[model samples]
Target chain A: MRPILISCHTRPVIAVKFNKDGDLFFTGSFDGKVSVFWSEPVERLGTFACDGAVKTMTVTEDSKYIVIGTAINGIFIFEVETGTKVKTIEFSSKIHVRDVEFAMGSQQFFMISYESDEKKQSVVYIYDFESVLNREQPSRRDLVRRDRDHYYRGVWGYLNKTIVLGTQNGIIDVVDTKTGELLLSHRAHVNQITSLAFSPDFSMLITASRDCFAKLLDPETLKEIRVFNAQRPLNSAVISPLMLNEGSPKYHCLVAGGQEARDVTTTATDQGGFEITFYNMIFEREIGSVRGHFGPVHSVAVHPRGHMFVTGSEDGTARVHILDQDYFTPAYD
Target chain B: MADADYIEREHIEATADGTYKITTHIKIQNKTVITNPDIERRKTLPKFGDCKNLSKGDIEGSINIEDKEVFLQKSSQVRAEENITKFNLNRAHKEKLDALTRRERAIMSGETEEQKTRRPIVTEREEFSVKVSNLPDNIDQDVLQNLFGTAGRVRKVFIPRGRDDNLPRDFAFVHFDTKAEAEKAIKQFKDYPLGHHILSVEMADRRNQRRNVPMSNRRGRK
Candidate 1:
C-alpha cells in the first residue's frame, strides 16, 4: 500500500497517535508542535504549539483534549477543537517528561519523567484529568519512582487499577496505582524497553525493546505469551485490532525501528532497517516490510479499526498507510 | 463419365500500373456429376509389382547383395586395426601435451619444485604465543603480562587497538618462552574471571597474518 506522506514537523517526529475514533491522528515532533491530521483524507487540520520540544503526547478518550510532554520539563494540555491551551505543568529544569497517557475510563492520566543527572532517576506521576481540563490545580501524586533504571514508557492496565511500566533494563513492572505497590516485575528483553503498547482488547501487552525483540505478555501476570524478533532494535510495536475481532481476523503486528541515530551516518540506508516490518502475531514470523523513511522510525500508531496506520520517523515525516484489501486475507500464513 | 452443360466467358483489361486484369466466369447447368465406374474399379484393384510372389524375407535378402556375417566380420577386422593405431597415437600425443601444459601452468602460477617443497619459517615467539580474548577495555599490556606471567616466562605482550580511535580492543596476545609454557597459560587462563568478563585463552593461529596488521595499513591490499 502507498502511504500518504505528511511532512510538517521541522524536526524529527517522536510520537504519532490516533484518537479513539480513528478519525484524526496527531504527530508530535522536536519542533515543539503537535499537528493533527484527518486520518481518511490525510489533510492537516491544525497544530498545537508548546514552548519546548515535544517528547510524547496522548489524547483523551473523547478526542477533546491532548496532553503533550516536552523536553523542557513541561506538560501542556490543549483543547483539540480550538487548539487553545488548557493547562501547563512544569517540573524542575533537569527533569524531562518521557511519556504520558490517559486512563482507560476515568478522569485521570499518568506521566513518566526522567532526570538528566548522573543518578538517572525516573518518576511516574498521576494527575486528575478533570481538574487539569478546568484550568484548576490538578491533584497529583507520585505513583512510582526509580533511581537506577529509567522508565521509558507506561500504559494503564485494564481499567486503570494497575499501571504497566517498561524500564531501561528491559524490566516490565506492574504497579498498583491505589497502593503504589510493585505487583510484578519481569525481564522482558535483554536491553532497554523503548515502548509499551496494549492490544486492542487490553488482554495482551506488547513491549518493544532495544534488544531487537518485541514480546507479547499477559498484562496482569507479566507472563510471556509470544515473541517477535528482528535484526535491528525495535522502537515501537502495535497489534492490529482486526486480530481480536469476532469475525475473520488477521493475526498481524506492525514493528518499526532502525539502527541507532549515532551510527546511521556510517551505515547504508537499506542496511539500516529504516522500515516498518509486519509480523505474523501468532506464528512470530516476519511477513513483509514497508520501506519509506530515510532514517529510523521512532513511533507507529495503528487506527482503531485496523484499516490504517501512521509512522513517525527521524526523517521528520509521518506517513499514513491505508491498508489494501488484500491485507485482510491470511496470505502470510 | 456424365456429360454436363456449362458456359464459359473471359474478359481482359489493361489498367493503371501497366498490369493486365483478367476475369473468367463459368456457369454449370448440372449441380452434380457422376464419376466413371471403370476408373473407380481400377482404383480399387490390388497393385502388382516385380516381387509380387516373393515373401517379405526373400525380398529383403535379394535387395541386400552382400553376405551379412562375412561383410560385418571383415569391416570389424579393418576397424579394430585402425582403432588400435589411432588409440595408441592419441594416447602418446595426449601424454606429451598434458606434460607440456602442466609445466606451462606451473610456470604461469609461479610454482616450482623448490617452492612446493619449501615451508614458511616460524619464529619461536609465534609458536609460543597464546591469544587471550574477552578482556576488559581498561586492561593494559602490563596487566596482561603480569596476569599471564604466572604460567611461564613472558617474552612479549601485545594488545591490538582501533585504527581511528586508538582504543584497545578486547583481545591481546601473550608470548611465552616455550610452547609448553604457552599451553600452560592457555589452560590456566581459560575462563579466568577478570573484572566482570571471563577470559577466553587459546593458542594463537598465525596462518593468517593479515589480522595482525592495523586496519588502515591492511586496506587496499586484499
Candidate 2:
C-alpha cells in the first residue's frame, strides 16, 4: 500500500523520539496524539501509526517498552509488535501534560501533570512499572502522584540515578530516580521552561525556552555555568548521546534551533527563517547558524553516532544535517 | 426568457470536418411542439419536417415539463394502445422492469446514472426526469426500444452523451411516429412504475426544437 496522508485536526507533530535501537519512534503532534511508528526492520513505508500523536517517547535503558506522555488522552504504553496496549495512566481530572520520560536504567517511569483542578495547583505523577518489566504477571503497581505547583514541562533521567525535570514556570527539579525523592528545584530560565537534556556524561544539563537563550547548568550545584543568547526563542536543544564516540577528539557541540518570526501566522515569509545554531558544549558561545526551514524550528535530535542529525519544523519538514567541529578542529585542539 | 424556459436536444450537426455552420435554426416548443432533424429546440421553432402540418407552439402559449393534463385526457386511449406489444423484446423489457423494482436496494447500489446521457426526455418534467433517475445506468438503444416500444411505434431512442466526462445520464428520450402512440407511452411510463425507474414519453420536438438547454448554456451552440 502507498503512504496515505493522515492529519490530526488538533496539532502538527512537534516532537518525534526514537527508541534506543531506533526500531520504533514515537511522534507527538499538537493534535494531542502521541503515535508510535514501528518498522520491523527500521525501514520507511513500513511505518504504521498508533492511535495518538505523542509529544515525546523514552525507552527504558534496556530498550524494552516505551512510555509516551500525551495531551488530554493520557499516557499510553505500547508493546510495539502486536499493538498490545500494555498500560495506560490518566488523572482525567482535566490534568494536561507537557512532557513524559522514564528514569535512566530503571523500569519505572515519571509523568508531569498540569494545573487542571485549580488555577495553579499542579502535580507530577510517577508510575512504577518495575513488575511489568520483571514479568511478575503482566502488571505493575499504580502511579505515585506528586503535587508540585512549581514543576512545569521538561523531565529526564541521567547516570542511571538522577532524575532531571524542567517546569513550565522556568524551574528545574532534580529528583532521585531510585527513591522518587526531590533533589533540587531551581528557576533555570527567565521564562517558561521549554525542555531539558543532560549530556551523555550526565554532568552537564541544558535548558531553553521563550527567554531567547539556551543555558548550560550544572545539575549538582544548580548554578548556570554559561549563558548564550540565541537569535530566536529556543524551543528545544539536544546534545548527541554518543558524543566523542570512537574518541574522535572533536568538541561535541551543544546545538539548538529556535523560531525567528516569533509568530505562527506570518511564518511563510520569514527569510532568515528559523535558526539552528551550534555552540561548544563546554565553552558555550555562538558558533554558527544553519538555515532553510521557514517556521519555528521546534525540536532537535543529534543522531546516535554519525555527525548527521535532524530538526523538526512548523513548516512541515524535519531536516537532517551534517555537523562537524570548527574554529579549533579536532586536529588543532 | 419565460417563454424559452424548457428546451431539449434533438441533434447536432457539423461541417465536413466536424465544424459547425455560422447560424443554425433551432426548434422550440412547450405543448405538442413538432421537431425533426432540420430545426433547433428554441424560441423561434422554424416551420419544418413533420412539424409542417401544425402550428409551431401550444395554444396555451406555454410549455409544461410534463403534460399531465394531456396525459390524463388520453390515458385510456394510451392503455388500449399499449395492449399491442408488437415486438417480443418489449415484452422482455417489461419483465426486467418488474425484476428490478422487486430488488429495490440493489438498484440503488452499484447502479449509477451515466453522468453524460440521461434517458432522452423533455426537461422540466419531474415524471420524465425522476423516472429516468431510477433506470439502469447503461441501457442501450435496443433495450430502450424493447422496454418503451410498448407505447407506440419506436422510431428512435436518443440517449444524449456528455462530450467530456462521459458519465451516462440516466434517462433516454424515445420518439414515436404518431401522437396517439406518443400519448400511449406517456400514459404507460409516466408514473415509471417498473424497475423502480419508469420513463416519460411525449410528442418529440421537431428536430429543430430538440433542445436540452438554453443556447448559451448548451454545448456546441455557438
Candidate 3:
C-alpha cells in the first residue's frame, strides 16, 4: 500500500505520537517544530514551535496538552487547542532531555535527561502534570539521580505506577514513580537501546536497540519473551494494537531503522535498510516491510485503533500509512 | 332403413348459341357420433415414471431411512468419535499454553501451531569496504591507510598489480572495521586530490565470481 508522505520538517524528525482518539498524530523534529496532522485524511492540522530542537514529545490522554522536551534542557507544555504556551521549565544547560512521556489518565508525567558534565549522569524526573500547568513553580522529583547509565528512552509502565527506562549500555530499568525506587533491572541487549514501546494493553514491552534486535519483554519483571532479528540497527519498535482485539487478532509488530545517518551516503538505497519492517509478533518472524524513507527511520507510532501508523524519519518527513485490508487478515502463514 | 334420403331435381335450359345447362338439388342428413370408451381411457392413463403412488424409497434405496435404530446408533457413534477428537485437541492446546511462561503466553496466546512453527526470514549482513580509484602509480598502502585512517579503524588494504610489470595498479580496496568508518572515508575522501590526480571513492560492490569461468581458464586467457 502507498503511504501519505508529510514533508514539513526542515531537519530530522525525532518522534511521532498519536493522540488518545487516534484521529490525530504529532511529529517532533530536530528543526524545533512539532506538526499536528489528521490521521485518516493525512492532512496537516497545525504546527507548534519550540525554542530549541525538539527531542521528544507526548500528548495527554485527553489530547488537551502536549509536553515537548528539547535539546536546550527545557520542557514546554502547550494547550493543544489554542497552541498557547502553558508552562515552560528550563533546567541547567548541560542536560539534554532525551524522552518525555505522559502517564495514562493521570496528572503526572516523567522525563529522562542526560547530563554531559563531569559526572556523566542520567536522570529521570517525575513531575506533577497539573502543577506544571496551573502553578507558578512546578513540583518535581528525581526518580533516578546521578545514574551512571545513559538512558535513551522511557515509557510508563502499567497503571502509570512505574516507568521503564532503556539505557545506552543495553540495560533496562524499571523504577517506581511514587517511592523513587528501582524495581527491576536487566541487561536486555548487546548494544545501546534506541527505543521502547508498550503494547496497547501494556501487557508486553518491546525494546529496539542498535544491536540489530528488537525484543519483547515482560513489563513487570523485565523477562525476555521473544526476539525479532534484523539486518540493521533498529531505532523504533512498536506492537500493533490489533493483537489485543478480541475478534480477528493480528499478530504483528513494526520495527524501523537503518544504517546510521553518517553511513547512509556511502550505501546504496536498497542496502541502506531504510524501511519499516513488519514482524509476526507471535512467531517472531519477518512478514513484510515498507520502504520509503531515504534516511533511517527514527520513530514510529501505530494508531490506537490499529487502522494506521505513522513513522518519522531522518529524511525530515513523516509518513502516515493506512494499513491494507490484507494486513488484518490472518493469512501470513 | 335410411335415416334421410338425398333427392335430386334437374332442369335443362337452351340458349340461342344451342348450349344446354343442367341444375341439380341434393338433400343431406345429420347424425350424432359417439367416441370409443377404451381409447379415451388409454389417453387419460399416466406416462412412464409419472405414477402418484410412488414412494421415495422405490426410486432410490433404503439409505433414505434416517430414523431407523441401526442408522441412529451408527451416527451417534460417529458423533461421539468426533467429540472425543475435538476434546483432545482442546486439551492439547491447553497443555501447550500451560507449558509457556506467563509472558510468552500473554504475547502468543492466539497464535496457531502452524504459525508458531514458521521460521523468521534471515537477511545477509553488509561488509564495510570502499573502493578507491584513480590513484597515482607510485601510491602504496601506507599513503592510503594514513588518508583513510582519520575516518575509522582501517582493517586491511589491498592493491592489485600486473604480474609482468610488478607495479602497483591505479586502484585499491580499503576495508574498514565498521560500516560507519567506511562511509566516513567515502564522504571525506571522495574526489580527494592526491599527487596531481583526484581519487574517486565509492562503496565496493562485491558481485559473486563467475562459476562458469574457471580460475585456470581465466589465468590462461590472461
Candidate 4:
C-alpha cells in the first residue's frame, strides 16, 4: 500500500503509536510535542507541548490517561478527554529514559533509564499511575539498577508479568516486575541490542541490534528461531499484528528500519539515509523495501490492525505506510 | 655642482616617495589587519639611500607593482593570513570579543526580548546547562536549537543515547555559554511546546553532569 496521508513535524519524530483500537494515533517529536489524530477521519485532535524532548509516551489500556515521558521534564499524566494534565512525577532532573511501557490492563508502568555515571549503566524503574493521581510524595515503587559491568540499551514490559531489558553487550534479561527478580538472562546477539518486539501471540520475540542482524527467538526459552542480517546498524524491528488465530496460516511480517550500508557518515551532504525493510517471518526473507528518509530511522510501530505502520527518522519526520493488499491476502496453493 | 644638485632632487623625490609609501603601507596594514611582505622588505633596508643605487627598471618595477597582478595576489595572500590569525584566538578571548560585539549591537539596536535571551548556556562542564525533558521525539537538533534560541546561543545540545538505540534517551542537556542565559531559559521555556509535546525545563543539578561519570559511582536512585 502507498502512503495515503503525510504529516510533517518541525523536528525528528521519535515515537509514533496507534491507540488500542487503531482509531486514534499519536506522534511525538523531539521538539517536545505530542499530536493526536483520529485515524479514519485523519483529523488532528489535540496537541500537548512538553518542556523537553518527547522521548516516549503511552496511553493506558483504560484510555483514561495519556502518560508521557519527556527527556528531562519528568513523567506527565494527562486526562484523555479534557487533555488536561492531571499529575506529574519526576525522579531526577536529567533522566535519560530509554523506554516507557504500561503493563497490559494495569496501572503500573516500567521504564528504562540510562545513567551518565562512569560505567554508563542503565536501570529499570517501575511506577504506579495511581500514585501520581493520588498526589503521593514518592511514586516510584521499584528501581532496578543494573550492575556496572552490563550497560542496558532497550526495555519492554510484557503483560505486567515480566520486564525484559536488552544490554549493550547483547544480553537480554527477563525479570519479574513484582518480585524484582531476574528470571532469565541470555546472550542474544553479538553486539548491543537496539530494540525488541513480540509477535501478536507473544510466543516469539524479535530483536534488532548494532550487529546488523534481527533475530526471532522463542520468548519462553529465548532460542534463536531465525536471523536476518540487515548488513547495517538496525534501530528498530517490529512484528506485524496479523497473527491472531493460533491455527491460522502464519502470515505475519517483520518490519525493520535503520541506516543503510555505506551511509554511516554523519555529514549533511553525505548520501546516507534509512530504509524500512519488510520480511516474511515464516520464509525469513526480505519481501520489500521503502526508502525516503534522509537520515537514520530510529523507531517503527505497526498498526494494531496490521494494515499500516509508522516509522520515525533522524530527519525529523514520521511516515505512515499501508501494507500492499497482496500480503494480507495470502496466496493459497 | 649642477650634477650634485640634480642628484639631490632625485634623492629628495625618492625620499618623498618613500615617505608616501610608508604612510600608505601603514594605512593598508591597519585596514587589512595583515603584515604585508613589502613592509618587511622595507624593514631590511639600511636607509632610503640604498633605493637610489638601483637601476631605472628597479625603480619603475617597484612602483608599477600597484597596477600589476602581483600586488593583487599578495593582497589576497594577506587576506587569507588575516583570516587565519583571527580564527586562532583563544577561547576566552573569542568569547570576550563575541560578548563585546553582542553588547555593542544590543545597545545600538535596543534590546528586544529575543536579543535579551541570546546568551551562552554552557560555559563549563556543569555550570550553565538546563535539563530539558518531555520533548517530542520528532524534534531533532535544529528544532531544539530553535526552541532554546530565544535564550541565547546554545553552546551544545547533548541528546543522551541509550546504550544502543539510535534515538536519544528521553531527556537532553542544553548547554549555554553562561549560567545566566541557562537560568533565563529555565524561566522562559518552562512548559514550552517544541512540537507536539510541552517541554519540562530546569537548571540542571551540578550532579547532573555530562557523560563520563564512573559507572560504579553512578547513583541512579533518588
Candidate 5:
C-alpha cells in the first residue's frame, strides 16, 4: 500500500468517510471546515464552512446529502451535488455532536449527541431526510437515551433493522429501531467501546475499544471470536469493504488506529507518532502497519471498492492509502 | 402602667392668612401598674384546663388478701415442692438461652471478621484523597494500585463512573493512609505519563462541591 498525504486541515482531522461509490471522500477537521475530495484524482473538490469546528460528519450512500455536526454549532445538512444548505438543525449549543451516520440504503441518518443539556443528554436520534428536503422540520425519533451513566459514543444500524450502540462502559446495546425495545446488552470490552464496524455480509462485527483491544464478535450473539491487541487506546476501527469477485486475499481486513499507550505528548519525535494496524481476517494475524502522523489517529474509513482507505489524524492531516499495489504500479509504469 | 396626673393647655392666635385659630389640651390620668406575683404565676400555667390538679390521679383501688389457708399440710407440701421445681426449671432454661445467645453472638462476630477479610479494605478518609485526571481508559486497577502504592499505603482507589453509562470518567480519587502520602503521590505522579495521557494530579474536591450551573441554551448561528 502507498500513502498519499492530504494536508487540507489546519487543525486536527476528526472524521474521514467515503461515499458508497468510492469516487468521493470527505474529511472534517477542527479547523471548522469539511473538505470534499475526488478520490481517483486525489484533488480537493470543495470545502464547506461550518459554524464551529467539525466534530463529526457523514455523507449519504447516494452522496445526495452531507451532514456535519459541531460542539457549539448546530447540525448542518447540505445537498452534496449543489453544495447548497439544505437544513439547519437546532440543538443545545453545549452538546458535542460525536457521531453522524447515514443509514444504509435509506433517507434517514442517525446522530449521537454528547455532553448535552440535562433534558437531552447523550442521546442518539434518527432524522428523516425527506422532511428536511421538503423544507419542513425533520421528524426525529429518539433511539437511545444515554443520560448520565449510560453514555454511548458510537452507533451503527444492523441490517437496517436494529440499531447497535457502543457504550462508554464497553457494552453494546442493541435496540429495535421501530419498537425502541432493548434486545440485548453485553460488555464487549473493559473500557469504552469507541467504534463498531460490521462486515459486508453482516455476519461478523468488529469493535474497537479504549481498552487497547479490538475484538471480532458475532453480531447476533455478541460473542467474542478473537481479540486483536493494539497496545494503545483505539479511537476508530473500520473493516475493509468486500472486493467484488476479485478473489483478493486482503478482502475484509481490519484497520484500527489511535493514541499511543505510553507516549503522552502529541509532539514526541521518537517512535511516538500514531500507528494504524491492519489485521487479516482469514489469517488472524497483524499483516501490516501504517505510521506517519505526528499525533494520534482519530478516525479511519474504508472505501466501498476496498482498493483504498482514508485515515484522519490529530496531527491535522488525512492520509489516503491505496491498498492494491498493482493499481499504483501500473500507473507508474 | 406608670402613674401620671397633669393637665396642660396651649393656645395659638389665628394669623391673617390662616384658615382658623387652634387650641390644644393634654390630660394624663392617674393609673397604677399591677405587680402581684399571683398574676404572673397564673399566666405561666396552661390555659386549656385546671393547671394544678390536672396532673393528679383520681381513680384508686386495692384488693385485700384473705387470711384463710385452704390447703391442708400434705397438699401444701406438694405445692411447695412443685413451686421449687418450676423455679429451678425456669432458671435452667434462662441460663441455657443465655448460653445459646452468647454462642450465636460469637459466631456472628467470627463471620464478620471473615467478611472483613473478604471485602476490599477501603479507608474512608476524604482528607487523604488525591484526584488524578487524564487517565487512559485501558489502565486497570492493578496498575493504578501499584503506581500509587509506591507513595504510601493506598487505602483505596475510586474511579468515578458516569451517572448513566457506568464508565470511569478518566479520573480517579486515590486515598492514602495519611495526607502526607497523598501529597507525596501528587508530587511524584504530577504530569507523568501513566498510560496514554499525562496525569493531572491534585487534591480532590469534596463530593458534590460542584454547584449546578445553568448551561447557556443559545441556539443557531450568530
Candidate 6:
C-alpha cells in the first residue's frame, strides 16, 4: 500500500498530464477542453480547448510546449505559460495516435496509434520534431510500425533506459531503450492493460488494467513488486516520480482510473465503471477514493511537485485533487 | 532456383508517372479569408453538449438503465393495491398503461427514491445491496464487501449499519446489475457458510415491502 492522488467528476476523462515543473498538471476530456491547475491549492490556473476529444498528452522535458492528442488524429502543441497553440501535427484518417512520449533529453518523441478492433494492431512512430518539420513531405511515413503479435497500448520512455509498453492483453513489456529490444514482459492482469507509468527516479513502473489490478513493478527487470486488486477494472495508472526527493516530497502515490467490472456475471473485465483511487505503497492501503463518473476511469497524471493529480474517465469527466498525507483534500483552485 | 519463382510484370503495378494515381493528396482551394469558431485554444472541458464538444459529449446521466429478466422477477409481485399494470392484461393495454403512468411525476418519483436507498445504506450501484448478519458482536462493512466482491459485477455490497449487539438483521443483501449475475452468485454462494452462518442468497424482498420491512423478524427496522 502507498499514497497516491486521484480526481473524479461527472465527465469521462480522456487524458491526463503532469507538467514538467511537477508544480502543475493538466487534463482533457471528451468535452473538448483542457485545464491547468495548481497542485497545492488545487486551483484552476487556466483552461484551453482542442478540436475534439483530447486523447493523450506529453509535456516536454523542458516543459516549454504541451502536445495534445485528439481523437480526430490531430496533435496540437500548446505553450505552457501563454496557453497558446504553437504548432499542429495532423495524421491521415487511417491512423489514430493514441499515446505520445518525449524521449529522454527531449531530443525526440514517439507516438503510438491504436487501431480500434479485435486485432488491436498499432504502430510506433519515432521522430525528431524539429528535424521532421523541416521535410517537404513531412508526414511521408512513420519511423517504425510495430509487429502484429506485439500489440502495444501505453508507452513510458524513462531516461531512455526502459521503454514500458502496455498491451491489450493486460501485460507490461519493458524494453531496453538503447537496443529497442524486449527486456521483460509481465502479465499484470487478466484483462487488457490500459495504462502504465515510470517513476522519475526510474525505479518503479506502475501498471493498471481493466481486470481491476493496479500493480507496481520493478522498472529494470519488470518483476511484480506489489499488486492491488481492488476488484475493480481500471483504464490507467500513473506513479508520481518526485518520490525520490530526499525531503519526503510527500508523494510516491499511484492513481488508477477505471470502473467496477461490468457484466460481473461473465466477469470478462473491462466493465468500465471506475473511481480514481490513491494507494499508499508503504502502507499497502487505499488512502483516498474520488467517485463521480458513471463510466470507466481512464488516466491519472500527477503534478510535477507530487501534490496533486488530474484523472480522466469514460464518463466524460476529468478531475483534479490535492494530496494531504493526513487525508485527501479537494483543491478547487 | 531460376524457375522457383516467376514474377509477372502485371502482378506488381509499376508506376510510370510523377506520382501514383492512388496517391493520397490533399486538395486545398486557395482561400482569401479564413473563418472558424474562436473557442478556447484547449479543446477540452467545454460545457455539456456545447457545439465545440467532442466525442459523444457528456453521458445522458443514469436515465438509461437496461432491465434484464432477473431485475423484473426479483422486483416482487406488488402483492396488493398497486398502480402498475396488472398481470394477465393484454400486451397492448399493458403498454398503454405503463406509458400513461410513467408520465405521472408523483408515481415516477415515488419509486426512484426507493431505488436510491436500495440497501438500508448506499453501496455501489442501486440495483444491488449487501448486508451482514450474526457476527459475534464484531464485524465491519469491509468484511461484507470483500466477501461478496468476487462473486459478480457487484453494484454495492456492504453490511448495513447495525446497533449494539443487534444485527441489520441476520442477513446480508448483495445487489447486482443483472438478475443473471444475481442468479449466478446465488448458485455459487447461497447456503454456503461464511464462518458459522449459512448464507441464503435470494432475490431481494419485493420493492413494496422494503420500507415496511422494519418490522421483519431479525433485524427489523426499529
lDDT digits (tens) for residues B1-222 of candidate 3: 232576666677888888676756576767878964533442333312112343222322211212212100112343355566655654553354344433345344776655554423211444577889999987878988888898998877767665588677788888787888988999999889999999999888653212212432555467
**Model 1 docking category:** incorrect
Looking at model 4, residue B149 earns an lDDT score of: 85
Candidate 4's C-alpha runs over 4 A off are A5-7, A117-121, A149-158, A245-250, A260-273, A331-333, B1-222
Error of 4 at A201 (Å): 1.6
| DockQ of each model vs. true complex | 0.01, 0.00, 0.01, 0.00, 0.00, 0.01
The CA-based lDDT of model 3 is what?
0.76
- TM-score (0 to 1) of chain B, per candidate? 0.42, 0.32, 0.38, 0.38, 0.37, 0.34
Q: Encode model 3's per-residue lDDT on A180-238: one tens digit a residue.
A: 78888777776789999899889899999887778999887888898776658899999
lDDT of each: 0.77, 0.54, 0.76, 0.65, 0.68, 0.57
A1-333 per-residue lDDT for model 4 (tens digits): 345333446787878777776766778888877776555434455566677888888887655678888877787777654467777777566457777877777577787777666656677877776776786674676556786535444445456677777877677888887788878776666667888877766778899887667889888777778876555678888887766734445455544555542455654422342667767677765555666566778788887877677777777766666555565444410
Error of 3 at A327 (Å): 1.8
Residue B211 shift from truth in candidate 3, angstroms: 55
- Taking the tens digit of each residue's C-alpha lDDT, what string does model 5 give over B88-125? 65455346545644544656477654655534443243
* Stretches > 4 Å off in candidate 3: B1-222
Task: Order candidates by lDDT, high to low.
Answer: 1, 3, 5, 4, 6, 2
Measured on C-alpha atoms, candidate 6 has an lDDT of: 0.57
In model 3, the Cα lDDT at residue B54 comes to 36
Which stretches of candidate 1 lie above 4 Å from their native place? A116-120, B1-222
Candidate 4: which docking quality band? incorrect
Cα deviation of A124, candidate 1, in Å: 1.0
